[model samples]
Target: MNISYKWLKEYVDFELSPQEVCEALTSEGLEVGSLEEHQAIKGGLRGLVIGKVETCEAHPNSDHLHVCTVDLGQGELQQIVCGAPNVAAGQKVVVATVGCKLYDGDKEFVIKKSKLRGVESNGMICAEDEIGVGTDHSGIIVLPESAKVGMPAAEYYHVESDYLIEVDITPNRSDACSHYGVARDLYAWLVRHGMKTSLHRPGCEAFKVDNHDLDIAVEVEDNKKCPRYCAVTLKGCEVKESPAWLQERLQIIGLRPINNIVDITNYIMFAYGQPLHCFDADMIKGNKVIVKSLPDGTPFVTLDGVEHKLSHEDIVICNEEEPMCIAGVFGGKGSGTYENTTNVLFESAYFNPTSIRKSARRHGLNTDASFRFERGIDPNGQIYALKQAAILARELAGGTVSMEIK
Candidate 1:
C-alpha cells in the first residue's frame, strides 16, 4: 500500500513533512516499506520559450542534423543544431539555457555555452519527457498554439513534486489498502493527538432510483460460493478519458488511467473500500445476470486478454448465452464496456472468501478484488457501495439509473 503525501494531506491536518509522516505511520503500526521522491528532471529550466525560427538548413557535417537559429525570447538569436525532424518556424518550445540542469535517459547534464557540429549553440530544445510530464520522446514537444512566447513552462504545466510512502500492511489490516481506510486510521490518530480531522466524502443523496420495466435478475446457484450480490444498471454514460485530477489521483496510487466509467469504479473502490465492476449493458446478450459455479470445462477471457479455463468449483457471472465475467475475480473481455458503450451494469457484491481464494489459486491470478475478498472485507456493505457508485457514475459520466439488482 503506497500512500502519497498529497493524498495523506487530504485526510488530516499536520505540519510534518513527508519523511516525518512516514516516521509517524511507522511508529503507530503501519510499517513504511520505502520512500520515493517525485522530482522533475529539468531543474531551474524555466521562462525560456521559442521566439522564432530564423533559418532551418540541412547540416553540412551530419545527414540527420538541421542547423537552425532560435530566438530565446530575448532579442538575440541562438543557433542550435538539432536532429529532430519536427523543428519548424514560429513554434513555442522549451530551450535549456546555460546553467540549467537537463536530464535525458538517466543521465543528467548541465547546459553550458557550447558548439555543436561547428555551430555555436547556446541551448537545446526539449521534449515532454525531458521536462517530466510524460515518457514520449519521439519528437520535440509542440506546445499549444496559444502558448505565450516567453512564459514559464512549469507554471503552465502546474508541475509539483510529491513523495510516495510504500506501506507494508499485515494480513489483518487489509482495510488499510484504501484511502478511506487510511483516513479512518489517521482520523483516530489525529483525534487522539488533538489534531484536526475533517475530511469531506462525496454525498449520495441527490441520486434518484426508480423501479421500471428494466430490472436486473441475479440467480446465485450456490449460496455457499456467493454470500451477497448487489448490482445497478446505469444509462446514458459517455465513456472517455478521465479528468486530469482523477488521473493524477490514480497515478499517485500506481494505477494508470483507463476511462471515466472504469476509473470511477476503481476510484470508488479505493476511496470507500469496495470493489465495483461496470459491464456493458448492450453486450450482455440478455437482461438476466446469473451468479453460479462454472460448468465443467468452461473457458473465458479476462480483462487482461488472457484465456482461463474454469472448473466446476469456480464461480462465474454469466448471461443467457455464456459467462461474461468471473465472479469476484475478473471481467471477461467479450462482454466488457468499450468507448462506444452507452449503457452499463455496475456490480458490487460479496463472495465467499474461501471460494474466491480457491478460484484465484486455481486460475493462477490474484487481482486486487480477489486479494481484498480473500482477506475478508465488510460483506454486508455491497448495497451501500452500489448506491455510492451509481451516484458517482451519474454525476461524472452523465448516466441515469434504470434498474438495480439486490
Candidate 2:
C-alpha cells in the first residue's frame, strides 16, 4: 500500500518527518518497504513560465505546425515552433524557455534553440505529460485567461513535493488498507507511546440528502454473501475533470484521476477503506439494483472489455434485467460512469471475504475493490462511506442527492 506523507498528515497530526513516520509505522507492525520523495511535477517545473501567444501563423514548410511568437513577460517576444494543431494567438500556455529541462521517464533533455520545419524556435510549449504532471500528450497545455503572463508555472500550478511510503501489509492487517485506517493504526501507536495526538476523519455530518430526485432501489438477495449494502443517488452531475486538489491527492498516492464522479468514489475508497462503485443512473433499468448470483455460463464483459462466464456462486449486481457489476470485484462495461453521466448511483457494501476472493480468482481479476473486499473491510462503515461519497459528488460534480439511501 502506498501512502502519501502529506495526505497522512491530514488524517493524523504528527510532527515526524517522512522517515520518522515510516519508522513509527514499522514499529507498530506495519512493515515499511520503502520511502521515496515524490514531486507533483518532475523537476518541480523549474524554468517554466506562463506565456501568451502573441502571434501564430502556419509554418511555411509544414502542414500542421505553427510558428508562434509568445510573450514571456519579457521585453522581447520568443518565437517557438509548435506542432500542436490547437496552438492559437492570444492564448495563455506553459512555456519551457531555453535551458529548461524536461523529463521523459528518467531521461532528461534540455530545451534550446532549434528548428522545426525550417522555422527557428527559441523555446518550447509544454504539454501536461511533457512536464510529468499528467499523461496528456494531445496538445500544449492551455492556461486559463486569468493566468498571469510570465508567472512561474510551478508557482501558478502549486506544484508540490511529497513522500510516498510503501507499506507491506500482512493478510491479517486488513484494517490498514486505507489512508484513514493507516492513520488510525499510527494514532494507536502514538497513544501507546504516550503522545498527545488525535486521529481525524473527513466529516460526513454535512451529508444530507438534498431530495428524492433520483431514487434507485437496491435489494440484496443473499444476506450470507453481502451483510450490508448502502447506496445513494446523485443527479445533475457535471462529469468533467476533478478539481486540482482532489487530483493532486489521488496522484500523490499513485492513482490516475478519471473524471469528477469516478475520482470522488476512488478518493473516498482510499480515504475510508471502503470500496465504492458508481453507476450511471440512466443505465440502471427499472431504477433498481439487485445484489444476487447469476446462473452459470452467463457471459459478462467487465469495464476492461474482457468477457467472463459467471459461476453459480459468483455474486453480481443487477439492474432489474441485466448484471451491472461483479459485486465487489469489477464494474460492467456499459453501466459505469461516463462523460455524459449526469445521474449517478453510488454503492458501498461489505461482502463476505470468502465470496469475494472466490469470485476474483474465478474471473482472474485482482482489482483494488476486490483486494479490499476479499480482505474484509469494515462492514459498519458502509453507510458513512456512502454518505461521504454522496457529499463529495454533490460538492465536486454539482449534483443533488436523493433523500433515501437504499
Candidate 2: clashing pairs of residues = 211-403
lDDT of predicted model 1: 0.77
The runs of at least 3 residues in candidate 1 whose Cα sits more than 4 Å from the true structure, single-residue gaps closed, are 39-97, 103-109, 115-157, 210-214
Error of 2 at 357 (Å): 0.4
- Across 64-165, the per-residue lDDT of candidate 2 in tens digits comes to 999999999998999999999788999999999999999898899999999887789999998888987778999999988999999999899887779999
**CA RMSD of all predictions:** 5.2, 6.2
How many times do residue backbones clash in model 2? 1
Q: Cα lDDT for residue 405, model 2? A: 82
Q: Indicate the worst ten consecutive residues by lDDT in candidate 1.
A: 39-48
lDDT of 1 at 169: 80
Give the TM-score of each candidate.
Answer: 0.76, 0.77
- lDDT string, candidate 1, 77-185, tens digits: 8887777889877776777666777666668878787777776777777776776668888878877667665566666676667788898888888778777677667
